[model samples]
Structures are given as structure tokens and as C-alpha cells.
Target: MSTPDIVLTRIDNRLVHGQVGVVWTSAIGANLLLVANDAAAKDELQQELMTATAETAGVGIRFWTLDKTISTIHKASARQHIFLVVKTPADVLTLVKGGVPITEVNVGNMHYSDGKEQISKKVYMDQADKDAINGLIDAGVKVYIKDVPEDKEQVLQKF
Candidate 1:
């Protein structure tokens, strides 16, 4: 198989914010931001907001559900540079289960919610989140927690 064009896979709840829209996009030189999120794919307002943010960074973006994302993996891989973003570890698990070749995943932000443990400044994990991360690691996908390109990477282990 040929090498996939997707250069980065990130699990960021704030899918296309200032950090991802500008810093990460420019840092990785990724021309495309493929947001694999079911909710975002159906929400017009959220889609518009993300698109506007991506435009500010001069990066193209497309939103798709887990199934659609898997189906279009071939075409997305043909693009020059793709920065894949998903909302949760569960989403990443879905993609991996669907045969997406994600060698690594960066956990940007999970947010501090009720019944969740603080894993990092920008990442919080509930039992389900922890389970999903473990599943990905077992699948041989390296997962790390980092807010930005400048932040030190924390390996997403059992926690």
C-alpha cells in the first residue's frame, strides 16, 4: 500500500479553534483539516464556525461522520497534507476499527466535565474515555496528550 497523505491525527474537542486553525496547521504544513465528528457534520452553525476558523489559517476543511470518514479515506489520503481531527477518543477508536492507518494521535483537549479525572491541563478523561484510549493503544496506535506543538508530549497510557 502507498503511504497515506494524512500527516497528523488529533483528538481535539475544540476541533478548529485558534490553536488548531493556525498554530498546528502552519506548523505541520497541513493543507486540509478533515474533522471526523458526527455532531459537527450535522450542525450547520458549528460547521460554519469551523470553516471560518480554518479559512483564517488558510487551510481547507471537510467534516464527516465516522462512517463517511472511513469511506473517503482513500480520497483523503490522495490529498497533499491532511490534518485529521476528531472530538473524542471514541471517535478515534471508531476510525481505527474502520481501518484508518493512524500511527499516532495527539490529544489536544477533552475538557473538564463532571465525573472525569484531570489527566492534563487541557485533557480530562472519564471511564469511557480511558477505555477508548486503551483500546487504541492495544491496536498499536501511539496516543499522546499535548495542547499545542510547543507543549511536551505526554504519552496516553492506561490513564
Candidate 2:
């Protein structure tokens, strides 16, 4: 049987970090990992950067860009059990605006930058960021914020 399409699409800046390697991977029972971002895609040298980081406990990785990701999702394919991930909520928002087929959005860890204010214990979402997230949710995307596997999954609406 062909595997399903993207099962989870998360918005976590630290894409292949601790949470991905340990919690999310097992919690979802997913094997394939795909990270889409411009810098990681265009840099070429940085290709497989996420792989080295994501291969902690034996996992496959594919890194794509915004344009590439959009194209791939549109053309259906029999993929392995893949959990697609993006770095920012804005990127997720952009995907929605581009009419991507992403339904579930998880906010893992959005670190605090200069202008970003801490919205929750594990989240640091700014107003514009909040607006983008809300737009996606309003457009019918199920957005959840959960830092680790053990932690409770809090819906982004609670923010």
C-alpha cells in the first residue's frame, strides 16, 4: 500500500532540534521528515544540514524551499510516512495563502527575537505573527502548540 501524504506540518523554527528527534517523531509514528525553508534550500552547501541534525536515532530527511514545497504538495505522490515541517508561522501562513493542502499546524518552539514578545510559556509570537496564525486558523487550519511530547497540546486559539 502507498503511504499517506503529509500527516503533520509543524511551525517550529528549530526544525530538526531536540523535540523533532525525540518527541514528535515517535509520538506521530512517522519515518520521513521534510523541512522547507529558503535559506536551507538555496544555500546548497547547507543542504542535508537538517539531515545530520535529524539523523540522531535513524531517520530520513528531505529539505525543500517554499516554491518547491508548493509544487510537490500540488502533485500527489506516494511518499513515505512524512511529517512536513517549516521554520516559522509566517511560512505556514504563506503556504496557506498559496493554497497549499496543509491542515494540521503545530507550533513547537518560536524563540524570542528582538521584537517578538513571549505569548506563552513555550511560545513567543508577535502581533503580526499572531495575525498570520489567526488567519490560518480562521481559514480552517487546526493549529496546536505543544513544546514536547509529554506536554499537553494547547490549541493556538488558547493563545
The most accurate candidate by lDDT is 1
Instruction: Show how many residue pairs clash in every candidate, following the order shown.
Output: 0, 0
TM-score of each: 0.95, 0.86
Error of model 1, residue 152, in angstroms: 1.3
Model 1, TM vs. native: 0.95
Candidate whose TM-score is highest:
1
What's the lDDT for residue 41 in model 1? 92
Q: After superposition, how far is residue 89 of candidate 1 from its true place, in Å?
A: 0.1
